[model samples]
Target: MQGRKVAAVVAAVGALAFVVLAVLLVPWDPVPGGPLHPPPASSVFTTDQIDRAEDFAGLQRIWSWSSLAVSLAVACVLGFSRLGAAFVDRVRGPWWWRAVVAVLALTLAGRVATLPFAVLLRRRVLAYGLSHQEWGAYAVDLAKGVAVEVVGTSIGIVVLVGVARRWPRAWPAVAGVLVAGLVMLGSFVYPLLVEPLFNDFESLPDGPLRTQVLALADEEGVHVDDVLVTDASRRTTTLNAYVSGYGSSRRVVVYDNLLDGGSSVDDREVLSVVAHELGHARHDDVLIGSLLGAAGALMGVGLLGLVLGRRGSGPADPRTVPRVLALVALASLLASPVQNGISRQIETRADVDALEATGDPEAFVELQRDLALTSLADPTPYAWSHFWFGSHPTTLQRIALARRFEE
Candidate 1:
């Protein structure tokens, strides 16, 4: 017993050290650039914008909290219920097929259960004029999302069951590696495969904006075969952009709303958006994110193995899958803060890169403000909420960062 206690202590210490190292290694400061004048506070937002922002922030908080609660409850139900095992037993198929069916049923059930919250959130988005997608279109998108989830989760469960059956003792480490590899592969393929289902993407026309985007990429040492413009205005009024995939698949995607004058995003704001995405490409943020995800998976699986080993049940045992799934869900929820912390750091660095690459802190500041207003983002989220759930820094923090860059 004393030996076990010592081992636990040592393990805890090691995990703490790893977390500290990760946080410390991340660059929290903006990149160096020439001195520039800071934009006036008044220029960031007007009185009317602030009032609108406050209202939107309150709505977002409500939606975020409710959605999280609903999701957690659903996860608990699926994970703790014997329904998964019963469903598997009722299905007449090979062991793999049985696992697949069980997973699909559970996944579908969870999706159905949480659909009300999804609808509620959508309603709020519509109310705020953030989304223009009709219910019909929304329903179609939701169906597609579920279909993708079913296929992906089914394959994953089958592979996991197979690994467990083949190597009960070694399954955790093996499965961890496999899961990590799949994550990387998924990131590599998502832009090509999954993204197209939601929106049509077309290459940006040869114009000043496109030329400036390509030039920014070159300056940032990021290769670009093309800049794709996504038709996001059909569903959203939010102005946004992103960098996805890697190598030949790597591309910067800008929202059509930003380019088509659906919002207040001007030419300079568009350039700022492109520059920020290019920063992601320049730093290979996708690869780094994949590696982080892989590490987290490895850790989670190892911990899962320890817990299951203590219970004297392996993944090969079909009866144990429900408990395993439950544990995984719990583990993921517990790890979210850490995961989000890493994300925020990466995003902040990308923001810094955007500022440096453009050497236009004023434009960056204006774009950040405009983005928040356009997306109806909360200017100042609750501290605990931001720490635990926020993937990007708060709008206020971003604005502050831009101001600091000017100094």
Candidate 2:
């Protein structure tokens, strides 16, 4: 009992430390003292545009939420009941092998259970002319996604079970460090190993746009391997760009659709997008985020240790994996607000950096508006939904920030 209490204390302390570090590092006020009076949605968008956006957004929100609900319900049923334990126990293997098999089975089951909603969501996107993916391609992508999830979940569960089996008493502290380290390592390698599986990439040709992008990278004092374009149009028409990985693996990736003939993005707007990504690179936001995530993982491991202690078993027993997975799902849902809040602020800082890098706010604003129009993003989302789930600043908030630079 005392040991369980200690694990609980460790969890509490780890959580507090994560919050403190996030506060210290996150750019909470990215647009400092920049007066912001966002124009009404109707002021910028016409009745038709607003109506279209609202309709699409409403349906998207519904399907997305329905999928999430189904996933969580599955998790709860498996975790909070004896059925999950019995299901995993039926697998015949060595303890670690059983753990691995259990994770694969459970993860695949959850994915299958929610697959209908996923199909519906995809169909809706197709209806709206957002996704170009055919049923065959979508199935292939879905399989890849399920494979990735299975591999990741298996690794984590196996590690947890093995460590707990080896060190019953002190596994909290040990697993905490181990989980944190794995988070950092995963962040470093994921871009290299996992991302290529989904998208095909080609370096931007030695053209004026590529040259300007290189110059922008130099101006921002960020080192990147190359500016590459990805065939994202194969999946969706969304204009997007990102920076991923760190050190040698770091690079800027732009969606090919961003440069397509039909795109509203001009060279300047593209620069704005690249500059925003560069801002993340400039501040090493990935490293910062990795650190935060590592901290959160450590805290989660501590709490999980306490939960397993209460259950009188840890991951070493294959049956416990389902319960663990369920708890993890619940924890993730609970932690979303803090995770999303920090993300929004980090994205805001990147936006501010874009404005500074280009010294062109009107182009940035235009880019934001066009992106919203393209995605059919609701200009003003429900307050609760935005607070809980909004990762980046709302499109209007971004435009408003750019407008601040106009002054």
lDDT of 1 by residue, 114-212 (tens): 777787778888998998888999899999998888787666667667887887656765676686677778788888999999999999999898888
- lDDT by residue (tens digit), candidate 2, 1-407: 76577678768878987989888999887886755677899877889999998898998899899888989999889878998889877888798888888788778888989888888888888998998888999899889988988888888888888888898777777778888888888889988898999999999878889899999999999887799899999999888999988777777899999998789899999999999999999999988999899899989988887887876855567788889999999999999999999999999999999999999999998899888988889998998999999999888888888877887
TM-score of each: 0.89, 0.97
**Best by lDDT, which number?**
2
Instruction: Give me the candidate number with maximum TM-score.
Output: 2
Instruction: Return the lDDT, model 2, position 407.
Output: 77
Error of 1 at 29 (Å): 4.5
Local error of candidate 1 at 354, Å?
1.2
